[model samples]
Target: MQPSTLDVTAERPTIASVVRSARPALGLYVLFQLLAFGVLWLLSWKAGVSPGRFVGAFDGNWYLSVAEHGYDQAVTVGPDGMPAENSLVFFPLTPALTALLGLFGLPLLPAALTVSLLAGCAAAWGLFLLGRDLAGPRVGILMAVLWSIGPGSAALHLAYSESLLVALVAWTLVAVARRQWPLAGVLAILTGLTRASGSALVAGVCVAAIVAIVRRQDGWRPWLGGSLAPLGLLGYLGYVAIRTGRPDGWFWLQGGWEMHFDFGRFTWIQTLEGLTSNESSWITVTALFVVLAVALQIWAWCTRLPLPWQVYNTLTVVIALCSSNYFQSRARFLLPAFVLTVPLALLLAKLPNRALAILLTTGALVGAWYGAFLMAIVHLNP
Candidate 1:
């Protein structure tokens, strides 16, 4: 197959130019983030918990630990005798960025928070670029706005790695779509270091590169990029293997945490049960979102998304659904699949101005409340 027709053979915009063009999207993103934080603050006040504390709860604390002290030498076991929270399960890039910021004497928490906030901005900008290239400037702005109001966007404001991961994933996809092979490869490497879900990105990049090579397009650049794309993930996995003296050290670590791939069996069972059970709202809400996400994937397949985007989005949702991890966390896991929002954004863009404004505003409010509820009320990882 030939390269994507979306490939840009024109001169690339400079960083400053891209930032200048992305100002509106960035401004809207900041506003949405502030609104989300405001909702979280009010909810936290009612719940008698500090908003800052809530943002950095659960996985954020582990990220902070890795930032401050690096990974522990031995895994600690919980009272139930399972291997306790291990920083190794957490990727390295976010903590590394947080630690780099901590060098300026900021505390670990603030450093991690700062890293997330800045990365959130970059993610918004990158999403804008991706959408603009795929559709138009209006869709680009909507893409950023939609991302800012995502149900899992609470993690963006938190000391979590989602912001960094999405930023890398967005820009890498843009590079791939534009056939900037070398840049795509570099970003894919960093993305691989950001999260295990980044494997989806690595797969997308490799697929695009292979397509170009088969068609004798882009010369040897695709070969180089595809070869470099997997290094970061393999490097980390190799380190773990050497450290643990096991070929599947990463999977072993995950198994200890009760996080293993079950090919959607666990998700299917839990989702059905959660939908019918009168358990916590978290389960019901999470299950509903999972169902909606699957529906969105079906919708996306019927749309005209490019091959790489299709591959990336499908793999991301599949990974999120197929994992045996915490069921409630699956929604947050789907945060990186931004392409799934394109159809909704396109539909919103077609509405009359007033109606569109009302719809987006309503979505932002509901999404904000959902995020706050997930964190403060349900007291769960988001």
Candidate 2:
């Protein structure tokens, strides 16, 4: 007897599953990105700003400068007597890619944007891989879509390190989940090379390595991988130290940019100021998301997310949020904290098609508009 149509359709295909059945997620990510960027480009055109000027605003300009000219002398100083927006604070990976592209005769800003766009796609693919492993194909697609349209998502398209860092971090975590220690180590190193948040990835890998050792898996691989995980971050810091001839040069340079880590006291002050001050409502919006992120970190811990993911996500949020100033960019900084989306993805995955469509449609519309506004109206770059 032949199988019924239902049985036949239900049986998974064997020969061509398309990257082991992640095509849907990849397609969805691409679709959402195209739609959102199309809207942003339309807005930029209306405002008479070119894509390069619009996308490579703020730190994008800094990265481009670093790529073209390398680090400049720190002669400029702000009122706080700190280094003023120097290039030393940025990690080398994204800028290095931009510089390499420039060697092929590409313009500096365009090369940075190209690197960011490619890295953003990679990040989306990695998110799909991890999301698929966590749930199923549709859930994975939803995760990718949500990320592409999430707050600060457009920063993925801009010349920011977030794109490459997220890609490296997501794939690193995926490797951790798969117990591929060597791969995880390499990605973790690259992650550290991409952004300061690479510290979180290194910590996550260390946690995973320790967990493996505690589970009685006697292996030199775990120790060796753990040892290599932090080299990218530590090595960069060492380079900065030598360049500045100070053990604390990086932090001092960040201070010149009106940025510093103050152990959450500064964040609490900002939150309180936003809540109490009436000069602007957007301040409160930033505070709300900061609070929401903290809550989600707690919620993730309570949920079934892996220990490594939990550690990494929490540390990333802590570092990203508990810093000095830049309240406007807090939401953008939270874009790659993909672990926070797991519970929402699980809940959305079980919803009816109509409900899921409504929720995601709302998210896409709102996120795209908000990001465009940030990209166009303010000095803030998404």
Best by TM-score: 1
lDDT of 2 by residue, 1-382 (tens): 1111111113444646636676766676667777778778777787778655677778888888889888775646667666676788888999899999999999988898888877877777778767766666666777777777777777877778887888888888877776778888888888888888789889999998998878856477788778889999988988898888889878877876678787878778888888788456566766776787788778777677677888898898888887877778888888868888877777788888899778887787677767776776554655
In candidate 1, what are the lDDT values of residues 262-371, reduced to their tens digit? 99998998889889974877778788888988998898787787788889999999998999978878877898988889888777777787896787778788878888
Scored by lDDT, the top model is 1
Which stretches of candidate 1 lie above 4 Å from their native place? Answer: 1-4, 10-17, 76-82
* Reference-based lDDT, residue 325, model 2: 79
TM-score of 2: 0.90
TM-score attained by model 1? 0.94
Question: How many steric overlaps does candidate 2 have?
Answer: 3
